[model samples]
Target chain A: MLNKIKRILIELGGIHRFVMRFFRELVRPPYEFKEIIKQCYEVGWKSLPLISLTGFITGIVFTNQSRPSLAEFGATSWLPALISIAIIRALAPLVTALIASGKVGSQIGAELGSMKVTEQIDAMEVSGTNPFKFLVVSRVLATTITIPILSLYTACVGLLGAYLSVNQHESTSFVVYFSQVFEAVSYLDIFSLVLKAVVFGYTIGIVGCYQGYNSSKGTEGVGKAANWAVVMSMFLIFVEEILIVQIIQGMRT
Target chain B: MVNEREHIDQHTKVITVKGVSKSFGDLDVLRGVDLHLFKGENLVVLGRSGTGKSVLIKLISGLLKPDTGTIEVLGEPVDELDEKALQLLRLKIGFSFQSSALYDSMTVRENLEFPLVRNKRHLSRNEINSEVEDVLDAVGLLHTIGQMPSELSGGQRKRIGIARTLILRPEIMLYDEPTAGLDPITCIEINGLINEVQEKYKTSSIIITHDLACAKSVGDRIVMLLDGSFERGGSFDEIFDTNDERVKPFYDYNFII
Candidate 1:
């Protein structure tokens, strides 16, 4: 058990060092603008469908599940306001980040791990190109920029799903439902959601790149990297969510 | 076999590894290995599968560092150079991998253009195009310039790997098992290419291989690495004709023919 703890500590140290190097290299010259734009398209535009579907499903299910409890208090009218706050403040950003942690994180890990195993990374190094700058920095910057946009889109689509669900039972019009939802949401909630998404995105990208870049030597190592990238990024996302929620709550008080 | 250290000019030595040692965990890959490569000479290091031939070449290229000693490539100590300095130094050295290591996402033209794109960033598109075309023509693979690495055969990929390295016009070339998984005919062709590259570019090189034909045909001198150190160093004929117990197994099959 002690050895396992020691190993985990060492791995965390490795990740910390990797992140520091990423920042150090980020400021260097010959920025990979083309690669960064390509990554943005891959991470943002390519992920729209999955993020939209997840947010829609989550919003509908949460409204359906919460209806009985709210109806018990004879408060079905509060459904739009409650669902809006839940989706905007927490669920949308959290779910989008988790999905991206699985999708983009696994891709970065597998791609880089295969490159490392095949010596393509080493070839890049010996060929006078900075693999860390080209691969890691571009992906990280893309995720950081894209994940917030994805979360914001998820929040919008999720509110639409909630509106559709509310109209199914009650006689609320689309404008009335959306007006109630937006009336309940403040600029602080939007700011916090975007902040959380950005942090989650950075964590996912860095973890994936670190795992894949330092992958062990084999096909097995590539699989392990992909697995660990998903696991670690998801774990970090949940942790960040809790901390951000607590911080936001503290600010409210 | 006598060492050929006396014949080489010290000033012409582009790469010099002195008492370099490396180990991973408990396995010692290279131990106290000393080597030197002069200008425009193909020095082939012959060893078995696990005899550190690849490790030695990686050390010369500064891909891996030595644990005990120093390696000087083109006058600067490899281990002491900073990241920027090492990257600049690597621009002068080209390493062709056994697995080709071409970027699978890129086309063959892009692969050949990679090093030039990074190091010679000031060149115009037409200039880069001509350089890529010239290197591809030199490797005789100008026809496959549009294909990706996955679309190429084993021999063609290896040729592209060489073309990618040669496009930079490096001063030193380090080939690690250049013809490892090819057929006999393709292997001979690669060997011929190695010789042609050496003659045309006048580049100093360290070719690591287990293939005797490749060693004999392309090497200006041959060094036998046995049990972690260079056990014999001389001309290909001298090392081949030796009767030393440590070096005999490598040449035994050739002798039976």
Candidate 2:
């Protein structure tokens, strides 16, 4: 048991070192701008359909689930504001990140892990190209920059779903519903959403890259890397959410 | 048992490994191995499976470090060089992996163009295209330039792998089992290509292989790696006549010449 604990600590240290190296290399020249743009298309644009679907469903389900309790208190009219705040402040960003942790994180991990096993990463290094910059830095930067945008897009789609769900029973106009949705969301809510997106994006990219880059030799190792990338990223996302919420609460006090 | 030091011309030494030893976990792969390569010579290191032939080449390329001793490539100590310095040195030395290691995500043309664009970013698009075309044409795979690595046969992938390295016009080529896992006809073609490449580019090389036919045809000098160090070093004919029991098994069977 002690040995296992020691191993986990050592692995954590390795990941910390890997992240430090990534930041150091991130600022160096030969910035790989083209690769970064390509990764953005891959991580952000390609993920739109899935994010949209999930966001829409989350908004509908959460609204439907909350309707009975609100109706009991004769508060059905407050549905738009309640749904909008919940979706924008937390659900949209969290759901988008979790979905992306499955999609983008696994892809990055599997692709790089296979590269490492096949020696393509070594080939890049031997050919005068920095593999860390070309592979890890580009993907990480793309995720960091794109996830917030994706979350914002998801929040918009989720609100549309919530509006439609509200119209299913009540006779609220489209304009009134949207106005209430906008009125409930403050700059603080938007800022927190964006902050959470950024943290979650960074976590996904780094964990995926670290697992893939340090993948052991063989086919089994590649699978393990992909699996670990998803699991660890999801775990970190929840941890980040708790910390950010606590900090926001502290500021409020 | 053989003194290979006399064969090296000190002034023209391109790579020198002295008393180098390496181990992974408990297994010692290379133990105090020493060797040298002069300019414009095909030096082959022959060893059985997992005898650290690949490890030696990797050490020279600075992909792996040794536990002890030194490897100097083009007069710079590879172990001591920083990442930037090592990357600079790597631009001059091309390594063709045993598995080809072509980027599966990129097409053949893109793979060939990677080194050129990274190393010589100033070249115009047309210049890069022509250079890519020329290297592909040399390897006789110009028509397949647009094809992915998965689309190519084992032989074609190997050729494209070589073309990718040749695009850089490296001064030294380290081939790790270049002709492994190919049909006999493809093997001969690759060996011929190796000879042609050495002559055309005037590139000194270290070809690591267990293929006796490849060693005899492509090697100007052959060294047998046994135990940990080089057991013998000489022309193929000289080593073929050796009475050493360990080296005899390699020549016991008649190989296709």
In lDDT terms, which candidate is top? 2
Quick one: best DockQ, which candidate? 2
The residue-by-residue lDDT of candidate 1 on B1-257, one tens digit each, is: 43343334546889889999999989999999999988777899999999899988888777888999999999999999999999999989989999999999999998888789889989999999999999999999999999999999999999999999999899899999988989989999999999888778878889999988889878878889989999888888788776787677768875565
TM, every model: 0.96, 0.97
lDDT digits (tens) for residues A73-138 of candidate 2? 999999999998898888988999999999999999999999999999999999999999999999
Question: Clash number for every model?
Answer: 0, 0
Q: For model 2, state the Cα shift of residue A15 in Å.
A: 0.8
DockQ of each: 0.86, 0.89
Q: What share of the true interface contacts does each candidate keep?
A: 0.90, 0.93
The parts of candidate 1 lying over 4 Å away from their true place are: A1-6, B1-11, B254-257
